[model samples]
Target: MKIALIGYGKMGQAIEAIALQRGHEVVLKVSIDNLEDNTIENIRKADVAIEFTGPESAYENILRCIEAGVPVVSGSTGWLDKYEAAKASCTAHNSAMLYASNFSVGVNIFFALNQKLAALMQPHPEYDVKMLEIHHTQKKDAPSGTAITLAEQILEQNKQKTKWVNHDGSNASDLVILSERIDPAPGTHVITYTSAIDDIEIRHTAHNRQGFATGAVLAAEFLQNKKGIFSMSDVLGI
Candidate 1:
């Protein structure tokens, strides 16, 4: 499939390498310096667009793709407040979009495990759940998007947690998500359920960006001829 990379940063470069290795062509690459290359005429040349840009620019980039009728696979985070608007635009334009907090295959599986654990611990309100996520210092979003996904899944199944707070879960109903940004750390997300008797923990660690890049390409492949909004669960069939 022909692909367009909307962001030419580390993640975008990694995705380009994997897409090329898989025999896919990257037709267009848009970076800060090459903003003019992100025009509708240029975007229409590709079957799909993979966006790994930052929060401030993600919405506009995805919107441009949808407007150009190009299927988009976006792994950008912290811009979810505009997700509904993006979905609405997609439906109106009959465009396809697949968005994920973390596109690593392992992270999605770990997400499933977290939901199940939350359900199992739902009836037993004695347990308290908290999450911690660590990423490279260059990462812009705090608590990481993956951590928010994990916390959301847990909150859905475990009624004890009505909300999530950063760094502090002193309140009984609050699910605390601690974040750390250190140099050279790819990413790590850990969830712990603690009770008076014991603690249960589940974690997912990424050694590099390849896993996420692979999954984003896979998502682009899945969305090549599809229409409507989708999540990683739809692409991975989770």
Candidate 2:
């Protein structure tokens, strides 16, 4: 497959290496310095485009790709607040787009485990649920996107908590999501259900960015000739 890389940073470079290893050609690499490379002609030239940019640029980047009549797979986070807008634009333009909070296969499994555990714990009010996520110091978001997804899943099962708290402490009715930024850490997410009797914890630790890169490549491969917005679950068959 011919691929175009949008945002040639660490993740972009990693994805490029894996795509080449898989015998895929990278036709275009658009970085911050070269915004013109993201134009319609450049984006439409590839079979698919993979985006790994910041939250602020994610929505706009996807919009541009859609306008270019190119399918896209984006792993960017924190711009989900505008997900409706992106979805609407994709439908309006009849483009294919896949977005995921964390593209790691392990993380996707953890997401399933999180939902199952939340359902199991919903009937038992004794257990208090909390989430902790740690990432590299350079990560921009406070609580990682994976953490937010887990928190949302838990809330869907347990209606008692309406929102998530991103700090060490929380109010009486809040589900807490703690964020820790440590140097050189790939990614670590732990969800705990605590009770007077015992504690149940589920964690997914990313050894490196390779898993994410590989997943992005897989998404790009799956995105060819596809339409509408999709997710990692669709890519992994989860």
Candidate 3:
């Protein structure tokens, strides 16, 4: 498989290394310095494009790939407001797109576990749920997307949480998601169900980017020749 890296940051480089290790080739690499080279023609050279760009550029980058007849797998977050538009574009072009807030296989599994736990705790409404996610200081978006996904899963199952707030919710129906930025921390997400009696917590700590990188490559492999929108669940069949 030929992969085009839409963001050449730490995650992008990590994906490239993993893709290569899996016998895939990195054909095109686009970074902030090389924005001009992100043209559709250049992006179309690869079998699939793996985008890990920021909110400001992720939407446009994915559109460029779709327009150029390239299948795209994006792990970018914070720009979900435009996700529907991207999906519509993919369908119109008869192309393929796969997106995941965090592509780590462990993280995706953690997502399922979180939902299951939330359902189990629904009958026992005494437990107040809260989340904390810590990432490297360089991470731009607060309340990391993985944290948001976790919070969303909890809100769906736990009736007590109607919404999620970054720090504190206005009332009990809000799920609090606390975010911390500390250097050298790749990522750490913790979901705790706290009550007067005891605390039950589930945590996923990333020692490095390899898990995410590997999962992205695996998604790319699964995305070949596929059309329409997909998620990590589709690739991993979770």
Candidate 4:
């Protein structure tokens, strides 16, 4: 498959390496300085475009790809408020698009485990739930998108908590989400169910960014000739 890459950053380079290893050609690579290279002519030439840009620019990037009649797979986060608009455009143009907060296969499994554990702990009010996520110091979004998705899943299973509170070391009883941005940590998420008896904790730690890059490539491969908005679950059939 011929691929166009938007955002030639660390993730983009990683994805390119894996795509080449998987026998895919990267026809266009757009970086921060190459705004003119992201034109419709450039985008429409590829079989698919994989986007790993920032939240501020992800929505526009996907729209441009759709206008070019190209399919897209985006792993950008914190721009979901504009997702409905993007979905509408894709539908009107009959373009294929897939977006995921975290594209790691392990993270997808962790999502499934979170759902199951949430359901299991729903009736057990004795346990209190909280989540903590740590990422690289350069990560822009607080709490990480994976943490927000996990918190949403927990809320779906347990109706008692209406919202998530980003813990500021305050003594609040609400469902708390704690975020830590440290030196070069790939990603780490810990969800705990605590009570008087014991504490049940589930965590996913990434050794490096290869898993995320691999998953994005898989999504790009799976999204070819497919239509509508999709998630990692759609790719994994979970």
Give the TM-score (vs. native) of candidate 2: 0.97
Clashes of each: 0, 0, 0, 0
Every candidate's lDDT: 0.92, 0.91, 0.93, 0.92
TM-score of 1: 0.98
Instruction: Judging by lDDT against the true structure, name the best candidate.
Output: 3
As for TM-score, the candidate ahead, 2 or 4, is 2
* Cα TM-score per model: 0.98, 0.97, 0.98, 0.97
Q: Alpha-carbon error at 215 in model 1, in Å?
A: 0.3
Pairs clashing within candidate 3: none
Give lDDT tens digits, candidate 4, residues 1-238.
Answer: 9999999999999999999999999999999889789898999889999999998999999999999889999988989999999999999999999998899999999999999999999999888888999999999988798999999999998866778888754543467999999978999999999999999999999999999999999999999988888888999999
Q: In model 2, which range of ten residues has the least summed lDDT?
A: 167-176
> Which portions of model 3 miss their true places by more than 4 Å?
none
- Candidate 2 lDDT tens digits, 103-165: 888899989999999999999888888889999999999888889999999999986777899
How far is 89's C-alpha from truth in model 2 (Å)? 0.7
- Model 1 misplaced stretches (Cα beyond 4 Å): none
